[model samples]
Target: MKCSRCDRDAVIFIRYNGEHLCAEHFMEFLESRVKHELRKQVDLKPGDRIVVGTSGGKDSTTTVYLLKKIFSMRRDIEIIAVTIDEGIEGYRDRAIGVLSGYLKKIGVEHRIYRIKERFGKTIDEIAMMDKTLIPCTYCGVFRRSLLNSAARELDADYVATGLNLDDTAQSIIMNFARGDLDRLARLGPHSVVKEDLIPRIQPLRMIPEKEVLLYAILRGIEFYHGTCPYADLALRNQFRKAIDEWEARSPGTRHSIVSVYDELKPLLIERYRNFKLNRCEICGDPTPGRICKACELRLRLDKIQNL
Candidate 1:
């Protein structure tokens, strides 16, 4: 099909927006939308540092590359990449290598932190401990804690992540389904939970996952294509598959769902903003309860290992 904007053959047809775009226009659309979303979240100033959470996947690879491109001439704004090595042997090791090489090539200062070092156990070792516990339960809790701690240690102004539309939509659905109003309220382009926590900005949150992958390829960004070995064991995989099927049938179902959630987010935040937050007694991270989820999980794991 011909590109609606030009004479070139179309590379993608955005059914929601009803536009057929060639490679050039597609790139332009993606970058412009990301920039708009980014600006809506936070305004970067001189001497501001953004710590990007890169996993060497398509979404993160695209996020880092675009951030550098957008602020290429801004000498005051420093972009650093941090890769959390979960030490999953065949999975995380390969991705870390790709992430390291990419960061070096782009001249971005990068850091790698291991879960084993921080939590005293790698994901592989934790997975061996208990058959009843899902791996993601450990991963999600540990990763968030590590990222927040890393951001604080780097003294960054903001933490940036590559959470795309599909991920957001699934999260919204999952939260609502599970009656998790507090977490649902926290969903947005930018995070504003606590003072000690660095605010996280999601520039690519409005972009679709497929488009992110396309953008990475078109921009010649290097990334690891392998999926996490334990990914299929999570409940998220079921939601992901269902959401993909819905999008395939309804064209813009994912976008529509997320857009509605975005509209409702303001009201949700206003309602939940006054909810009390306390520091985890163990790790001193902000938590709704006395202890944070990460510490709770760690205690459980430690107990299981002792037995």
Candidate 2:
């Protein structure tokens, strides 16, 4: 059937809060989200460098594509693509190939930093060593450190991530559930970059996951379609599945929950400042403990092999 919205032939069905959106309408939805977020959080000046961490997955790949297109239209910004190679056997390598091709096609400069070359351990090796901890948690910790360090090395003004609404919302729920006001207060469309902190910004903070997937498909963007093999065993996976089921029952349940959190953000901020921030003695990132979680995890892994 020809889509009423974009005249493209409709394939997959997206019932967005009782409104039927074909793939093309879905793409518009995602684009609108990106535009809204950009207008909200970003103010680009000429020659300002925006570094985007891409994994060639649906979210990050779509992020790069949109940012490149959007920034290319304006004369005020430079976009740089950086992909962290986590050394996941079949996944990261293939994703790197796809991302490189896309970047080359559009004449965007891209950098791929491999974990094996930078760190001594592959994600798989680390996972094998730390079987008790979820693999994603370890990967996330290492990836964040790598991304921040790389952004600093690149001398970029802002580090952009493909964290859409679903990811941010899930994190909000998790933090609230754990009473982690410090982290929750820091969550928003724009986070101010501190001298000691490499600021990470999410331009698609309001876009839904379903919309992002549709955007990737409609734009013919190449992405890692397979789920992270280690994701099934993670607690976040359980939370994601639970939210997915809820979304099926109520089309925008996740968004609604996040909206409520946003409404209560001021109170969250008050609670956050009530607690004093401390520096990690090891890495010096803001942490309540003497050593940050990432450093602690790395030291733990190191000791395990030594034992």
lDDT of each candidate versus the true structure: 0.89, 0.77
Candidate 1 lDDT, tens digit per residue, 1-307? 9999999999999888999999999999999999899888898889999999988898987889989999999999999998888989998899988888988898888898889999999999899996888888899889988988999999999999999999988999988888999888876555564658688899888899989988888889999999999988988877888989998889889888888898898888889778878999998989889999999989998899888
Off by over 4 Å in 1: 191-193
lDDT of each residue in 86-128, candidate 2, tens digit only: 8888888877887888788877789887766656788889888
Pick the lDDT winner: 1
Highest-TM-score candidate = 1
* RMSD after Cα superposition, model 2: 2.4
List of clashing residue pairs for candidate 1: none
